[model samples]
Target: MNSAVTTLWEEAGFPEQTVIQRAVSDPLLAGQSVVGIAPTGSGKTLAYGIPVLTRLVPNLGPQLLIIVPAQELAIQIRDVLTPLAHRLNLGVLGLIGSANRQRQIDRLKGKPAVIVATLGRLADLIDERKLRLVDIKTVIVDEFDSFETEDITTIRHMRQDGLLAGANLGLFSATRNDDDIAAFREFWPDLQVFDEIKTDDTRGPVTHYLLDRQFEGKVQFLERLGREKHQRVFVFFNHKHIMQKVAGSLRFTHVPYSLLATDGRQVQRAEALGDFRRGRTNLLLTTDVAARGLDVADVTAVVNFELPNNITTYIHRTGRTGRMGESGTVYNMGNDHDLRDLRHLLGDSVTLVAEKPLVKKREQDDETNDENTPSTDSHDRARTRPASDKMPARKPTAAKSHNKRKQRWRNKKNVGKHW
Candidate 1:
């Protein structure tokens, strides 16, 4: 490693290079194409970041190009590498869809040495002739599985056109299944594959608990967690509607929370993330946008407002906490059926402990008591109802029955008299 890079690492107080970082640093510095598979929060960014910076020439025009799936990820990588890049007299810039294009073009005029960009924004700039790939030496795609077929096609087209002919490629991700491995071979035949899943032990132990609750109950449960001191929680949801619903509920409660939406503007998104990181917000409500390659320190726990649809999603969500050898907890909120399915989906990869009966009894009592209290806000009342009390279907009202009879009579009269 370069002396400057090593000094910065020491200053940052990272104990040592993680397994994946050490494995790939040499190969990457040697200008070889490498695929590094490491778990989330295992220091994967710095794994390739150090090597990329060491090889960068000062005042070079975009020698390192990092392509990520989301705007937040791009901004995150840029932020993480900027300080180190500056120590070596290099500059890092982010090109994301939510930011102003004119501003990015102006920054491009500065000829930043490193660019972390989403595929779409990068492709646009390239098409407009505002950004050139000739100087790019190391092209890395973080969260490799997040790239879709179209993204791969864009990359392949660039390679075929000789835009990136001289650049070495690096693909990194948290989890890569067998099918993903097969697909990688089909796409990048010459790529070197590295699987560090079994070897990388940097992730701290994360205790998983099943919170068997329905949607409203989940919101109420979040309120309860808010009462605890020093709780920084990342709340993950499978659907945007559910996330929005929960956010609305939390707004009325005492929980200090922030909402991270995929379509939100860059500034708003950054502010939301900043709020969570700076401890202004105790809970962050988001989808998979924050699931991959996003590292926030001291995230004590992750609460799943809804169970992830797949094992990979589950892994990444739980990974939000328990990062870099820090102990964390995960609360998976769902009903009995959801809990059973989650266990089946996770299989042997993770073990889920059921929430204790005593705790459940207390929570249920709290919910019942809250519901018994009077409140003018119908929404609040609806949200605090115990999950069990919400199951029975509502009976048809008199107004609805009268309207249905009138509609039937009108239809019958019109059948014989079609004038």
Candidate 2:
């Protein structure tokens, strides 16, 4: 073991002979393939990063190619590894959709020791021949289970070309299933198996509040939560049209909320997220689009205006709130249909309480200013779909009003004479 890495791990308070460390240290793993299962925040990044980095030195090529499911997770891993790689004077690059490709291409030419990126963009670069992975010693698919099912074919082709059917392949995820591993093994049936999470219980983040209510009552529940706690809230919807309708209703009700639909421009998505992160906006009305890998640190709650299609989505949606060491709530608001769906998935033991309608309207001036704010796209993708999921091809329509009936929620503790 590298003394520096061992020291760093000890400083991190990580246990010795952890699953991650063992996987990284095994002699056979250098150029082998395996499925890695580990709990969230369980030092998985370092586990793979260390071995990959060691291969890069004295070797000439992009030794490691890490494919993450989300841009934020790519950024998070990049942040986590770049520093550690630097400790050994190694080069690391982040290739993400939101960032410039020209720069990434320019850096790729330098033969970076490691490249961390999302699958779509990274695969695009590989297809374009901008980054050759022929000499990649390690190929880490961070969230193999989350990769878009449609892209699995493409991934197989790339694996053949990039890995030359021989590079070491490592797949890691917090939640893993035997079926997923079996499917992955079909890609390389000879691959070794490491089928276990270090922790026995891989609990998810956030406090789940499964609320049984009318479809219309969700807004009232959210309005109350917003007033009771002046913190950021991410509201999710399974359908984009439903999310748009929800945004329109919030506008009509003068609710303090912003819609982040996926159909908007990249800059708009970035700005909406920035506004939320910077505390310029307290309540955000979005769909699962914002659920994956977003670092909206102080998000006090995740309001599921609609239930997710599956248990995995439920885990990811709630994971957004209870991030790092901070605790938060996940409120799943639903109708009778939603309740039935939940019963089929989570059993009937979960209890839900009826919360009072909470509303503290914005001041007259704030309302006027909100009207001046630009209107949100009814086709907003952020409020509707997760990045990994695709939307159906459809025609567009006319634009809607931006400053739709927004009520400013200034603190009641500081209500001025203007109010």
lDDT at position 221, candidate 1: 80
Model 2, 218-260: lDDT tens digits are 7667656655646888888888888877666666555566667
List lDDT for all candidates, in order. Answer: 0.83, 0.66
Which runs of model 2 end up more than 4 angstroms from their true locations?
7-32, 39-43, 162-164, 190-207, 230-232, 248-261, 278-280, 295-299, 322-327, 348-419
Q: Residue 179: error of model 2 in Å?
A: 3.7
For model 1, residues 96-171, the per-residue Cα lDDT tens digits are 8888999999998888999999988999999999999899999898987877777777887887888987888898
RMSD (CA, Å), candidate 2 to true, equals 15.7
- The alpha-carbon lDDT assigned to residue 318 of candidate 1 equals 83
Output the lDDT of residue 214, model 1: 79
